[model samples]
Target chain A: MIDHIDSKIIALLGKDARMPNNKIAKAINVSEGTVRNRIAKLLKKNIINISLIRNVNQMDNPGIAFVGLDVEASLKDKIAMQLSKMPEVRFVSSLMGRHDLMAFVLADNATELSHILYQKIASLEGVQFTESSIGLKYFKYDYKWGRLLSEAK
Target chain B: MKNNLDNLDIQILDLLEEDGRASAKSIALKLGITEVTASKRISKIIKGDHCKVVAIADFEKCGFEFLLPMGIRVHGKQLEQVAEKISSLDAVYSVSAVSGIQDLEILCATKTLDETVELLDVTLPAIKGIKSITPAISSKVYKFQTDWAPLGND
Candidate 1:
């Protein structure tokens, strides 16, 4: 369970992951040791991750597509596992709705996107049909999950 | 926007991707470069707006039990307007304009089934010019890689 201090620390880190412990301590009015220990605890619990994320908009000719799959009921989980293993598949999730599974694929260009959608994913045994949406522009990709941390029980 | 990054920049990014807190001195030693160069490159990458070094919370662990991917078909010229509105919602993590049947795709995080239903049934429909919505709840998330550029380049 995350307390007030933990949420405060998380909010600061969400803005600048590289902010020094001393700086965070100053900002949050906590000791450097406290902040350090809290961050360590958070990491150990897999509650948060501190890492570098590339801005997709900065890349040249980057192709990002979301492919929704209708699959054989019995093979949904098996097929999702296979999609997860593909290098180009960045996000694979088993869904409950019109599509049994949804996979987000990232590639170099449109040609590669087509290949992944048609040749690779479509050929999977359980995939009955696929509907893909190529992301033309990214309006927002906010990773500041800190504000919502307070809502966590 | 095209990346003007050289080999060294990519290497530094790769190291940072593994550990965002990896010190400039440690990165320099690992890549056989001067500490000043590593530090400068790190500043350049970040200050230049190439990428961000940030903490990403796993939604499930952070009390968000539902990850809903909703596809919205907008009414004619309201695509941009609708996308902007959806992006403003606190629950929305991402909103992107796409090609094909849907005009916009959004990934939303909610805490319960009731909230998920409210979002799909009540909240979204209340917004004007939304032609239709197709919603899906992710039962399990297998992979969600944040470092796409480095991984794709390699």
Candidate 2:
């Protein structure tokens, strides 16, 4: 659980992910060392991860879409391995309740999307069915889940 | 360019947008600015623009089962109003007014396929001046974050 100080650190960091620890410490009235220790712990425990946020849409082939699959109980793993191998499929998830699996794919255009689906996904063995949706714009992409816990801080 | 952003400013913006938790020292080193200067500039930038850095989560993790990009072509002054209404819907994430046959593009996330269709059938068509809507469902997401890369000209 995040303590109040930890929460402050997170709050400040959320506002400026690139803020220096010393600046963060100064803002929260904590020592720089304390801020560093907390950050290290957060990272070690998988509370925070640093990664590149690339705009896939602006890339060489930028068409992105999400496909939800209803997999046959017998061939879940096989279908997953095959989809993962496809260069166009960037993300795949095994879900619960409604859809069995969800995936995120990128292609050049409508023609490319059709090829990935009809040629590749449709040909894979034991794949029961698939449904898809594409994203148009982005409004809020909150990386800090901890902020949701702080009563809108 | 004559915009408010200098080269270093753009670099800082790029780094923060990609990973909001980047340290000032690291950002400064990347932009060749002093850490103190970077820290001061970040504070100024946020204050000036009222922008906050955040993580872009995985849509699936947030219980959003469907991601649909819908293109809607509309007529007249009602375009902006109709787009605003659709964008405000709980399931609707983002809306854009584009060129050509489609004047508006909406990104939506929902729990079930039925829910998404219901919005299309019930809420969307009711909006004024709406000519048509075409849906492009994302089968997979390769990358969607808006963090533009820093300069590395060859």
Candidate that would win on lDDT:
1
**Per-residue lDDT of candidate 2, residues A1-153 (tens digit):** 556786677666544555778998999898999999987875565444443333333345445556667888888766876776776776554554336665656676767887897778867777778765554543333333311111111
lDDT of 2 at A97: 38
| Docking band of candidate 1 | medium
What clash count goes with each model? 0, 25
Query: In candidate 2, how many clashes are counted?
Result: 25
* TM-score of every prediction relative to native: 0.91, 0.52
Candidate 2 Cα deviation (angstroms), residue B62 = 12
Instruction: Tell me the lDDT of model 1 at A56.
Output: 70
Give the runs in model 1 whose Cα sits over 4 Å from its true position.
A144-153, B1-3, B32-34, B149-154
lDDT of 1 by residue, B1-154 (tens): 3258888988888898889989899999999999999999988886665777888776877788899888999999998889889888888988889999899888999999899888988989999999999988888777776664321121
Window of ten residues with lowest summed lDDT in model 2 chain A = A144-153
User: Across residues B1-154, which tens digit of lDDT does each residue of candidate 2 receive?
Assistant: 2145676777787777665676788888988889999998877654443244543333554456687666677777777677777766877865655544466656677778888788878888887788887765655443343232111111
Best by DockQ: 1
